[model samples]
Target: MTGSASRPRAVLIAGPTASGKSALALSLAERAGGVVINADSMQVYADLRVLTARPTVEEEARAPHRLYGHVDGAADYSVAHWLEDARRVLAEAGGEGRLPILIGGTGLYFKALTQGLSPMPAIPPEVRERVRALDLDAPALHARLASVDPETAARLRPSDTQRLMRALEVFEATGRPLARWQAERTEPPVLPAEEAVRIFLATDRTALRTRIATRFHVMMEEGAMEEARALLARNLPADRTVLKAHGMPWFARHLAGGITLDEAIEGAILDTRHYAKRQDTWFRHQLKGWSAMTVEEAAGLLATMA
Candidate 1:
């Protein structure tokens, strides 16, 4: 693996939703001649622009943006896919002599970029279908995983249906626990920590809660409902990642006459605030060696780079 000193410099901005990460990244990118890359998983889908709070058209017009709204909603995009796309974009940015500024709240994407990822075996379509069709709730799935792969099951939360399902599928396909495969990871980090300026934007909890609620309201007024309608019109599978974008389920309920628009808006707002809390917690615990600062402080630090 190449040393960090041999790698080109990049910037990484991460934080909870409504934390102004996009604005900071755009401001720095425009002044520094940097390419803004999407690190948030949901923002990559073309179908959830408003709900995901992806950069607006005007924002994209102001600077070079990569990987935003570039994936089909029906596809099951994963961190592996994101890392590959990021590698390509980072290379492109380097070749063009532009700084690469990756921004998002997805901690796993940043982790994979700096710490590499495990190489899991390919899961056949039949195995995936079998695992997904087991007619079990998350806790039940976790129990089932315990029977086959106790180590992995113990590590995953009983409430995490997606990860439980993935663990089950891995065990079924390879006759080994997912943890075993993860232990064999040999991929090198694409951008080592020493080669980049990493910052996690911190906001007071009360202020962040207010911001999240306000942002959801703005999203709805700006056509989040219509965006949800279009995405639902596609009839993607329930398990598709895009279907679970924040506010989507609530909007779906509202559109289906199961709830009023006001109820939908409130539900979306509440859920988003909860998600933001989770994002903040995850970054604090999982992302190490990252500078934590308010937006203004980060901007000041980044201005020097420009």
Candidate 2:
């Protein structure tokens, strides 16, 4: 039998932010006896619910929700961590005869679920700290990485500090290129795509941009500043994933009196728009065979899946 045939079928709902994927997932979960699980990386952190646009308590109460706010903001929550949690959740849902609805805009998470992920060795704290202590600019780090692991360095943009640092850390930890480890991957995919109904919410570019702007505005009005303030006060380590959240830098500046609230909002909206655009592009190219539809259409299709 194929991989999917041995497991209960799951539904994967993916889309750019503000595309109404969460609402659609909730409606479908309520109707289809499915549990709505978070696939978005940001939503896993408890620190930025409003800014991350995580499902509200009322929405979550409407359906079974899993993995939302299960992680602390200061934690180094990696894809491996998420994949492990997700596999457990999937098994639990299967055991209960409940459909599993995985929904999020994080393309990497969905990809890992369907297409298996290569194992990355854990970088030692000393090596990680050494890299972080350099505080090198992206270009300088990229140059440094190029000297040690040119193949990985070539693949990353000079401005991609996180990825550059990751590559450098891997090299420092293992004396091997990150690409080499990736090529050695043998782990099996957790969710076979053929066994799941994949839905991609496609919105018009203009509409998505407008929605992005509106959502940020709402976030500001809905205690997003307070959330940012609280998180900043915790003084978490720099490499924590929560600090890389969209609007974080701008919010920090606003909190520090380095920028006006209006400027921070504008910056956050622009960043979100760029991120949404990247998400749209990624789903279009990386996710094959998914049924791309509007949110309304997706809600209608859920009954068929159920």
Candidate 3:
């Protein structure tokens, strides 16, 4: 076996957007005859393919790929939902004795694989809507959560609307604080620690920011505006998962005459730069223990293994 005898062979290729994560994963999969598994949250949904920059069809044909572009936009897919999907794929891949390569930039997906997830049920859409309508005003919503579930409320930052809403809903539905429920449901990680080698692509932040900005420009040149326009014209509320895509809001601003196309495109670049910075920060501190390698280094490393 490629991995420890007790655990199935697996490889993880993770990094920020526009960092060539998909290419690396595909190369590794081709070398090892491994199956590529999607680990990015956005890439799971069926819609927003061009926006999410999912793997191209030619790339999928180069290796066995799973879980890419599988769900519809209407689904409020959570980490729990993704975990369930991954667990099934892991089991299936292990049974077939095929190496599994989990790849993408969504940090939470990797976190769930390694550290295990809290047993929180999906929060209702209405409850989430109510929380979001509170409009990122931390103090006011914090005050509301404090009245009903002070323990859970105490742990959340005032601006954490998504989490605060989840905690509040759990309290209302179960008559218990969300923290208490988390305590009760902690379980062993589904993906064994020794089964996989974790590798992170380390690109220079400045270089990566330039790449992000450049890619957004390419996306625009490649009909991203039309894609965004169609998606926006769907009349889905701003809070819908599809409408909240990273580049959508800025483009929507342009569409609504709030800004010019030039300004909107510039905003997209700036936003992507900031997103890359955040991803770099997360990979550094949050994934501190993982092996860090450059793109060239990764290619060399895979060559050796092959």
Candidate 4:
């Protein structure tokens, strides 16, 4: 990783959903004359703004924001795409002499910004279709991957269907395991850790759960269901990542009459809470050398940086 001798060029605020990341970023940007650059995967979609809990229009107007709701929902935006966009935004911030504050719950995005991502060989369309056509659940796919690329399979959860399939596809296309490619990182990190003030908000689990549930209710009040309906109306592919935005599938099921609205709300809340838990775990295990603190503590620390 590269190091910078000057003061920190950027601030990174990462945490679980409903952990006050957006609010804190906005406040810090306002104080520091910074640009708020999004690192959240879901919030990048223009289709599910409400469900993804993007900043309000008024809040966005308070500070310069970049990379929020910029991609079409039909597009399968990936970490590589986000990284490319972020590089440009970071460069612009540097040229304009503004502090760049990147805030989100997506651990992979943060990791990509700090430690460079590995470049995987592209899977041919035929290989991808074959993998997608296989009649197998996540566990079955994982078992299959274990037969071919046990090293990569051992690292992935059996329940992580998306990543499991990706690993399997890589194995099928290339003769090597996914792990081999990951061991050789060709893409350099955009913001090396030494150049940024990196923080992970460590909210109490109970408090975070309560906040997530409460915020889900607030999203409902803000027409998250309607947002889901509009996105659904576009009839995008079910595999599209945007369709899996928190509360989106539940709302779709509710709209389709397969579940009651109340049930959908409860399901979405449970899913979001579980996702928050996963976010916390990923940061703890995957990200290194980041200060872990409560939101209040983070605010104070970032205030000095601002």
Considering lDDT, which of the candidate structures 1 and 2 is the better prediction for this target? 1
Per-candidate TM-scores read 0.82, 0.82, 0.81, 0.82
Across residues 167-277, which tens digit of lDDT does each residue of candidate 4 receive? 987765444578878887667788889888888999899988998899999998999988989999999987676887778878888899999999999999998888788
Q: Taking the candidates one at a time, how many backbone clashes does each contain?
A: 0, 0, 0, 0
Q: Higher lDDT: candidate 2 or 3?
A: 2
- The reply for model 2, stretches above 4 Å from the true place, is 1-8, 119-180
TM-score of model 1 vs. true structure: 0.82
**Cα lDDT, model 2, residue 65:** 97
Question: Over the stretch 264-292, how does candidate 1's per-residue lDDT look in tens digits?
Answer: 88888887787788788878887899999
What's the candidate order when arranged by decreasing TM-score? 1, 4, 2, 3
For each candidate in the order shown, give its overall lDDT on alpha carbons: 0.84, 0.83, 0.74, 0.83
lDDT of 3 by residue, 81-169 (tens): 77889999998988986788898877767876776764674333323444555564667778878987787788889888767767766
Candidate 4 runs further than 4 Å off: 1-7, 119-185
Report the alpha-carbon TM-score of model 4 versus the true structure. Answer: 0.82
Residue pairs that clash (backbone atoms under 3 angstroms), model 2: none
Candidate 2 vs candidate 4: which has greater lDDT?
4
Worst 10 residues of 1 by lDDT: 1-10
Best lDDT goes to which candidate? Answer: 1
Off by over 4 Å in 1: 1-8, 118-180
